[model samples]
Target: MSKPPLIPFSTTLFVRDTCLCLHVQRAARALARRFDEALRPLDITNGQFSLLMSLNRPEPPSMSAVASLLAMDRTTLTAALKPLERRGLLETFVDAQDRRLRRLRLTETGERLLAEAVPIWKQTHAAIDAHLGEAASDRLRAELLALT
Candidate 1:
């Protein structure tokens, strides 16, 4: 059999430096870590904080609504709800008008916890925005929203 040629190392370097998906993933992970650390004292992960925050609405949100906002599938959203439910931070119940649908809402305890988390989130977020500068941060957010 004839030997096959290997891909050039320069090609590897090019992708490493210029791949948008790779860069975005790396930045997302770093941001998650930063937020996770900031929220550590509250015993919540960044994902948990976001989930709890999403439930803060005038009326409870349907499972599909919450899932869509979080960009998660039903199964994944359901699984994520379990820990918070167990903690008495939130509740999920069958919809009154539609027995087959589930709706989620923050419990009183969840609201209190989220209240404590907000200042921490604000401080951490402000620091990050400062690092990026006001204009760059605004532009970056606009670009990210455009992508989604």
Candidate 2:
């Protein structure tokens, strides 16, 4: 009798079995692409949108605070703020009480941009909810947030 054929562990099998990371990454990319396309007229990326939203709270936040909120390190956050700062969307100033600290503020331009972007963001958000259905999407978002 012939021996039974053995299955080899190929890259494809490995990827298929352990590809949740890839699937999540691809989904994030797709979602970002959709948001980018939708926000193009406003000239904002999703990251920027998030940053702007973070700064839209009642009080101005410190650099470290904003970085913590965004789950980004100080260096990465600094780099990300460059374009927004250059565009007059945000400004960083030395803290009055703590000279060593830098505070992030949304300029008038930033506020205006965010106001314009809100409707675009709403449309993208609505489309996603519509595609996934409200309950499922909400539950998925809750799960994802929990993981984060």
Candidate 3:
């Protein structure tokens, strides 16, 4: 086949500079790195911290609810839960009222670890907010929520 027409270099530059999805992904990865580093002393990834925090509730939440809140599929959430479960940080059990539903809860160990992690998370978040300025940080959160 004949060679296809090449996309112009300027078009590539335009997309690189202006693509919202690309920018968001880059920012997310950077933020994840920052949080991961901050949480590393606790032997937890940023994702795990978020997962554990979600499980802190008066009643255990259904697996589907946690998955939805985390924007993860069931299988991915299940895989993510395995490490925490193995560590005895959280547990998954069949719902008492609904045998078909599985629910998740943080164990006492998980709760304590999460409690410790909160200060670290808060410190990191405060630094980030300060860097962004409180108003800008709030606006960015609002914009991100709107996108979601």
TM-score of each: 0.96, 0.90, 0.96
Q: Model 3, which residues run further than 4 Å from truth?
A: 1-5
- Which regions in candidate 2 have their CA more than 4 angstroms from the true location? 1-11
Error of 2 at 4 (Å): 17
- Model 3, 1-148: lDDT tens digits are 9775598788999999999999999999999999999999999999999999999989999999999999999999999999999999999999888899999999989999999999999999999999999999999999999998
Per-residue lDDT of 60-121 in model 1, one digit per residue for the tens? 99999999999999999999999999999999999999999999999999999999999999
Residue-level error in angstroms, candidate 1, position 94 = 0.6
* Candidate 2 colliding pairs: none
Runs in model 1 lying further than 4 Å from the true structure: 1-4
lDDT, model 1: 0.96
- Residue by residue across 1-148, what tens digits does model 2's lDDT show? 9775586558678997789788788889999999999999998999999999999989899999999999999999999999999999999999999899999999999999999999999989999999999999899889878888
**Local distance difference test scores for all models:** 0.96, 0.93, 0.96
Cα misplacement distance, residue 8 of candidate 1 (Å):
1.6
